[model samples]
Target: MKRGFLEACVLAAISGEESYGYQIVKDVPASMGLTESTLYPLLKRLEKAGCITARSAEHNGRLRRYYRITDDGRARIEEFLAEWPSVREIYTYVEGAHHDAR
Candidate 1:
């Protein structure tokens, strides 16, 4: 199943020890299999909602803005986790029985 739209940012923040846009673009596919365009706007919204923050850093001699999840972002992840069981069950059942040609 495709990860939820915002899931990339949350996981990316956690994985990067805090990360910037390029890092997220690189890591998200490994974590969530999402593309840069899909993840960037969600990060922007998370920032706007105070669910994350960013600061500039030097990496490979280029400046980049790194992101960290806020307390609220953590809370949101918890909420998503709480809801995951039902979502997972539904998808699992659907996929298992779906298009079976036996």
Candidate 2:
């Protein structure tokens, strides 16, 4: 179980490029689960911390807020990337152990 922190998931979401809130929430669960309450504050905090920036655009007559990773966010992602191997190793070991037990 490589459950990541909100910042990690949010960072992962924007690693490739920018994304809207709904897209981030929607895409995350496919690989890592995230709920509205969990993601929203993280976004706000990141915005305040200068790790991300937000912009609004009209989509289907509805204004959607999009979050883009800034230089600071990219730097944070690099830090996370450096730490990820250990996290991944734990999950892989757990999964392997479970399979071996069967």
Best by lDDT: 2
Off by over 4 Å in 2: 1-4, 85-102
lDDT string, candidate 1, 1-102, tens digits = 354645634554554388767667776546465567867777788889877887888879988788888888777777777888898899888888885744
What is candidate 2's lDDT per residue for 1-102, written digit by digit as tens?
Answer: 243366877877887888987789987855556777778888998999899999999999999888999999888878888988998898899999999999
- Residue 56, model 2: lDDT of 92
Per-model clash counts, in order, read 0, 0
TM-score of 2: 0.73
TM-score of each prediction = 0.72, 0.73
Which residue pairs come into collision in candidate 2? none
Clashing pairs in 1: none
lDDT of each: 0.71, 0.82
